[model samples]
Target: MTHAPMADPPTTPAQTAARVLLGSAMVLAGTSHLTVARDDFQAQVPVWLPLNKDFVVLASGVVEIGLGAALLALPRERRTVGWVLAAFYVAIFPGNISQYLSHQSAFGLDTDQKRLVRLFFQPVLVLWALWSTGAWPRRRG
Candidate 1:
């Protein structure tokens, strides 16, 4: 008979806390995307994108909310959530690049140095998603 995979516990307490914090952060950021920070988020939307900035921001907000909620609610699927969240971080990275290159100020990253520094954090977000979800350092046989 076929069997379901078991929910794997986080490798450490730090991982658990990371998962909770990152998930909460995502939800909060998404909320801001659809609310007070809409214009700030729009400033980061690449000019080359054919879609409307507001629409893009709103859609991404919904996506973030869903993914964040999933990460928090689906402990059994933590690994998958981690991978997906990491990919999402990667997918949104171009916005960061655009913000830096186009000199679009938002979220207090007004200075070139600040924007450049922000770029470096994308990888950390990816790592955070992976580590928190126990997706990286793949299991051994």
Candidate 2:
């Protein structure tokens, strides 16, 4: 049986830059979830989720911190982390939708138009994660 190479393919300088930027951003955002923006993040939690909003916020904060650190520190696992982070973005989408639908204002998305526009950025984050970490690798023909 042929064993696959142990290492992930090398990323380009641009990809490395983007990954680092995203990793740093995640760490900062996670920090905010546990600190200054805790309440704001909680405000975005959907009431229907059943879990306590504060617990959800704090738990996600910890998760983000871990994922961000891993992304920064684990090049060999970058693709895995990228997929997971993209999934995380997808998983939390309802919070953004709830903020819009429930008319709960937080994180400067106080207006209907602003909230609507903000929804578009989540997909961009997903793409950024995938592309930066080579999860969505280019065709290798």
Writing each residue's lDDT as its tens digit, candidate 1 over 98-122 gives: 9999999899998999999999999
Off by over 4 Å in 2: 1-5
Give residue 135's lDDT in candidate 2 (0 to 100): 92
lDDT of every model, 2 decimals: 0.92, 0.93
Which number leads on lDDT? 2
Instruction: Itemize residue pairs with steric clashes in candidate 1.
Output: none
- Model 1 RMSD, rounded to 1 decimal: 1.8
TM-score of structure candidate 1: 0.93
TM-score of each: 0.93, 0.95
Which ten residues in a row are the worst by lDDT in model 2?
A: 3-12
